[model samples]
Target: MTTAAMRVPVTRGYRFEWVKLVSQWRIRLVVLACWVAPALFVAGVSQQATLPVDTLFGRWMHATAWAGPLVLLGFAGQWALPLLTSLVAGDVFAAEDRLGTWRHLLVAVRSPRRIFVAKALASLTVILLMVTGLFVSSTAGGLLAVGDRPLVGLDGHLLATGDAAGRVALAWLCALAPTLALAGIGLLGSVALGRSPMGLLLPAVFALAIELAQMLPLPVAVRLALPGYNWNGLFTSPMQLRSVLISVVAGLIWALTATALAYLIFVRRDFTNLNHDGSARRAVLAGALPLIALGAATVVVLAVAGLGAGSGIGQDKVQRSLATAFAHLYRVQTGQLNRPDVTEAQLGASAACTRGGGQTDPEGPGNDWRCVVSWRLPDTTAVGSAIYQLDITPDGRFVADGDGPKEVNGYFLVRTPAGDAPNPLWQFDGTVELLPKG
Candidate 1:
């Protein structure tokens, strides 16, 4: 007379969970928003006259359609990726408790592990869809609105349309690694907090903390271990294998460790209490302060890190990088001047860069980096020297100003035939590689 045990396949749980997820208006809205946001950004950027010069690929916004996706990629790395991951992963588990439905779901499934796996798969599927939608939308919108012109590469060279498109696509794919790591963090928060709002808030707070840590004077090895560093290689010209390797390894470690902890806790934690008496309100109130406090802390860190990533500049690398970067930019300037064609090879550039007015062995990041750059222009045997003042980031990005006034090759808004524009030589941007070269 006993009822036959309900025979259910594990994949059925996934199917059920996925249906629940897709049925939610909020979930649909999130996916739609991700797709629309990038396209909207592209449209807005296409209409704008001024460039977001400091943002990655920003200075090239009006110059090429490809800048649209890359600029958005940079913004996503700063915070959007974490926000999106948390929006889904942070709520997937906790929402069950918030609705007091965990017990019902457990009763039907008879296995907590099965339910966990189902929910996780559902969450990850949604995330993949959202990321893919945003990427494709951005690429399509940029090409439509801005036109598929060649892109300005990081080294100040022009990248062909096909090459730029491939790089942009690859950059988005590389971005997925850090995003998975973030999802793991959000997952643990959802399980531990057991309140949907708190779960979401927790990952936001965690991401802010990591952002602050990145601004600290951490070692390259330590910094590379953080999920955010994975995006840096995306900006490299040919892309660096070391960056991809680090991204995969670091992201995997974080995802596995955090997800393992979440799994253990989820499988064992008691759901008997079902009593959420005033817990949601309390969690909300409690989480509010942390978010505010962390946001403030992040701002403070940015201001300080803006001073420098803890004097991490290396003399030899800075010297070599500045010289090479200058030669590239010099070629750009010559082209703009309508001069005879100049090749990067013709600018045999060398630099004797020193730090802190020789007070320190060019060993750290600072505003006081000085380089006496010597380069021979085409048809000139004479090596001309130009003084450059550099503000270098620990990660090797720099904004360098040529010494003296505009007439002496100092970079002011140069008078171009089109109009006054950023002097390609005056205060141009560049970066140095922190990773070992092949």
Candidate 2:
């Protein structure tokens, strides 16, 4: 055979397989799901009332972070992406066996290796296209719904607008690492099953099993073996580039190993009895073992770290400090000291303080008293001390305080008891009111 004629058959095989895989509707659906799911999730979060304006983008970003990578993983992970990838990959070899066309194609093309390469390339192309589509669609949807606002970080600090966008993009890219490893697994399953279903179903089942195993208590070394945990480097803010690099290296190793295993099995296995019943069961067990062990170890390490960290100091502290600051401000402005004998209603309405001596009025019946109030509320805990001035009116109808002449003046209009006439003496700014002793 001339070298030119030899090249023709190989070139034709590549084109034929490429067209077949690309035209498959299953690959199209996975791509669609990737875009649609994140868009819907972001839209739903936008309509929620309780999510603060500042956090809307941050929360939405997290929801869709896994969408792009997981779409790729679905092909490689064994269930969703694997199933999709397998629609073409699994059937690449199996379809030939099922149709009794394997021997004929091998004879026609005269090279099983070329056919395998073509199919692998097609499957990978589809995976990459779907991943790209997902990233673009989800990022656009999230940005549209939430607006291009700066995101609030986990620590209650705000991330700069450009930095937040960059971090979000990095997160999506990080998620892609696991999917690459999953693709290799899918290829292995494709070769092993000699049928699409086994190749597709086993990878998915393995992914789930790994996820479940990671939930178990285990050591860090074991946990690192699971593909899902390795992708977490993508979500780490401030960009843990070192961790991401490590995950990439690990993922590449998994891909290479799975690909080698698939090649060996395909090159050696007999396709004559492709309908063999036990093959499916064998494939399931083979995929499950390593995945589950790795997952369990990952879960254990995470749980131990979480428990050791202790219960997190929550948002309650922030609220408490703000409340305390307001409480102290109120106490300084009013001379009424908080007393156990005071009614709950009175206590709630009054700012209590201890009386301190000040300028006295000898010409009138009433006395002038100076006072100080010290109280702490949770929000104001950061502010150690606060003080305010108070002045009781001559007839005891009002109390007034100001930092300077009319500069920071305020009054509490005293509400008189029921059936009692209004008293100018008790009247003050918005806060103070005299109730008859009960």
Candidate 3:
């Protein structure tokens, strides 16, 4: 056979792989589930009497159309994302092994490299579609549940409908990196293990393990470097470029490494040694395979840790975040009270914050920070000042609780004209900036 005839274009194999993939009823079902399940979850959450305040935006399901996707993003990172990626990418190569069709595929393509490329591209395309389906369905569900009101963002800014939609969409787009990272691990399993079930199982286990590791009392740099944690940065107000970059860089490195290893293994396999019945395949570096995966994950974490180390946490940033959030939420509080014409500008909110009797520098995460908040009400010369206790985290999130019992800040319900409503000042969520100074 001519050399030209032996080397087929990857595009042909790509199309063939895609058709083979979509032809499966299971693939179609997975896509449908991605679209249907999130909407159902949002609908259910909306109807529940109690809100899920533990999640970032879960308490606001009835307040805005952006919360559903944000909630789903949090939920998925725990387990759904790994499972979602593995369902397809994990099985892409292993399915052929289980069906005893490797020999047939090799005969058709004659180039394992091209075949691997085709399958990888096909699986990734499907996974991308699945992610998109989730994004769209979640957003649709939020709209149905909440009727598209302005979103009070993490920073306490009131985001208009279009603006909230834009940020939520961008956040969803940013999720693609972690999805790809987990997918890489799945693909590695599919290629190395040659069992559809193992391929599917490994990535889910990887995700759970990552989540468990995050719970340890590890240093902030190490926690930030963990594979899926960077999703938090994507939703931060004004965007944390360093965190986003870490997510992308870590994901790309891990993905490319795993894919490259898989490609190398796939291309070098001696297909001519298949049994007569095409089922007696010896193990493919069984022990070394897992070691390789573990080593790759470890290396990526270390490299990414250095990147997160420079993202300084200090006093000024936290103060700015808390003060701004206080201003924004103060307006919300007044509006809830049926106070007329009370605007953020008119409120003139400001705060003076300190750490641990001025003994500790106002830097880093702590539970002992205090802030004295003061804001002017419309048509009032008196300045109302109240102390706020702050609990700050390395990720730039802060929960500021109102100090005085009479002051209505912290996670509490307040009386409004519409009836009992959430107090914007109570246990309010806000963010400090994490970008490294230029």
Model 1's alpha-carbon lDDT is: 0.73
In terms of TM-score, which candidate is strongest? Answer: 1
Ranked by TM-score, the better of candidates 1 and 3 is 1
lDDT of 2 by residue, 1-438 (tens): 864456435567778877876676865676777667756655555556433222212222332332222233222333445445445455566666566677666666656667677767767777777766666765666666656665533221235667666765665565566666677777777777755566665556656766676445433334344565333223223333543454565556666666666665665555456464226554555544544554455446545544212111112322222223234334322323222232222323222332334334212112233222233434334322322343332111113233222211223232233332212112122111111111
lDDT of each residue in 1-438, candidate 1, tens digit only: 322256346789889988998899988998898888788888688668777877767777776789888888878777777888888898888888778897788788878888888888888899899889888878877888888998766566667899888888888888787788778778877876787475776667777887888666666655665666455454556655664666566666667666766777678767687764224443343433443443354445433544223333577778877787678777777777667877777777888988888887677566889888888877777777888998876666777778954543575667767876666667666676665554
TM-score for candidate 3, please give it: 0.83
Residue-level lDDT for 7 in candidate 2: 43
Model 3 C-alpha lDDT per residue in residues 1-438, reported as the tens digit of each score: 885588768999999999998889989998898989888888779778887877777778877778889889888777778887878888888888777798888878878889999999999999888888888998888888778888887767788888888888877777777678788878777876775466667778878987786554444455555566455554445656776666666666667766776777677766676432211232235323644565456656654645345335677777777777888777788778976756667777777788998888777777899988788887789888878898776666677888765646634788887898877777666776665554
Ranked candidates (TM-score, high to low): 1, 3, 2
Better of 1 and 3 by lDDT: 3
Q: Any idea what lDDT model 2 has? A: 0.46
Per-model TM-score, in order, reads: 0.85, 0.57, 0.83
lDDT of 1 at 390: 88
